[model samples]
Target: MLSATPRTSLGREKHRGSTDRNDLYQVLDTGLVCHLGVVADGHPMVVPTCYGRVGDTLYLHGSTGARSLRAADGAEVCVTVTHLDGLVLARSIFSHSVNYRSAVVYGRARLVTDPDERMDGLRALSEQLVPGQWDYARRPSRKELAATAVLALSLEEASVKIRQGAPEDEDEDYALPVWAGVLPLVTAWGKPEPDPVLPEGIETPVHILRRE
Candidate 1:
């Protein structure tokens, strides 16, 4: 686990530095998509898409038409992975914000060029989408790997910000007649639908069917 080099604000509190990065990896592994931000032609853009973490690197996959993929090539990009655990309904609307665990990873992304590593990256990307899918489905041919674009960003410059529990209201506001508690949020997967072209024998593997 590499610590951040202090390129950005760590956190508001003194002990808020989450530079261990393993925690960030854990959060990223739990979530399938991330809001990837990068500067292109002097403008900032944030694109939402799926991602996967293999050790310290975060891999983002996209199609050829995606604008974010074009901007990420050889550019310093920021990817944010967030999970909303609850909604903090405070006494005042101004004090309201979702309780979330989020990580911002900063690094110049390089388009994966190695043939061997490209397939591995694609596997990680696929597993993130549907666990056990990589092994269950046919592997990509060399030509398929060459067509897909994958970017790997390191965990060197990243930070995590979390807000949990109940809302923080002012002393006077707490006495006011208003609701102030947490409405817990959750994310879950539905039944896996098989492809229409599939042969009848295939079934959902345990990894996908049993994931918590």
Candidate 2:
């Protein structure tokens, strides 16, 4: 079950809140990018970045010189991953809404320093972005690793909210002639385009080509 911390608790739309921890994992895993919320220089900053999950830990990586990463390390932060499933069109504009799966995690993100764990975190990050590319592409060198910063945030305190199905409108509004239904938003991978400078014989990798 997810923690019921005050920050994680949903004061409104309680029915949309999910206590199942798996739902939290599902929301994070399906999403490609996460919005990292942190307080930098006494100002709130929300940055969209790529992330990876390993067990209950979420890994965020960027250049060591990035101010967001610098401020997030050793400080409390909020990370959110959301997937918009559909648009809910109702008979009345007041009832308009969206179907989405979202998860918000709250914890103190720590900068990873252990060499082995750092590599593992980086590997997880790379694998999350492209499954088989880590093995197929050239690995990072020592200097590259030194310039990168990885932060690990625990998923111990989090919240998951999911909304689906048709829109809900007022009793009288439902009887109107206006159409009310959900327009699902589907995301699909397009055909892979190779680099312009690549050798002619080097074809697109099987892992990328097989993505759906």
Candidate 3:
């Protein structure tokens, strides 16, 4: 179950809210990018970032010099991931909406300083981006590790919302002679584009070529 705290609870659209913890995890797992919100120098900042989840923890990494990650250390932050599924066209403008799945997590990000934990966090982030990339590519070196910073946040407080299917038009509006249907959106991977400088004989690995 999700927390009922004021910050995490769904106040306005309670009908779309979900209490199943698995729903939160599912959204996080399927999402490719997340927006990290933090307060920096008394000003709010939101940065687009990649993240990884390990059990109950979410890991975010960036260059040590990134201001957003620096300010996130030991500070409360909000992380959100959303997937646009389709556009709902209704007979009335008021009933028009979008189908989507979204998750929001709130917690104080703990700066990961320990070398072992830091490496683990980085591994998670790498694997999240490319399932087999961690094992396929060279691991981070000590010098490279020093230039990176990782933040760990618990997935204890979160909210999940999902909206799907056709629009809910009013009874009177349904009788109108208006075309109404869903415009479904689908995401797919295109053929791989090889790097210009890559060696001619080198072929793309099956793991990457077949990645979904």
Per-candidate TM vs. native? 0.87, 0.98, 0.97
Q: Number of clashes in every candidate structure?
A: 0, 0, 0
2 or 3, greater by TM-score: 2
lDDT of 2 by residue, 1-212 (tens): 99998999999999999999999989988888999999988999999999999999999999999989989999999999999999999999999999999999999999999999888888888888889988999999999999999999999999999999999899989679998899999999988888889988988888999975
**Tens digits of per-residue lDDT for model 3, 1-212:** 88878988888878889999999999999888999999998999999999999899999999999999989999999999999999999999999999999999999999998888888889889888888999998988889998999999999999999999989999999889999989999999889899899988999999999999
Residues 40-157, model 1: lDDT tens digits: 7799999898887777778887775578899998899989888989998999989887888888888899888777777778888888888887888798886776568988888777
Q: How big is the RMSD of model 1? A: 2.3
Off by over 4 Å in 1: 1-7, 11-17, 196-201
Candidate 1 vs candidate 2, lDDT winner: 2
Q: Which model is ahead, 1 or 3, in terms of lDDT?
A: 3
Give the least accurate 10-residue stretch of model 3, judged by summed lDDT.
4-13
lDDT of prediction 3 = 0.93
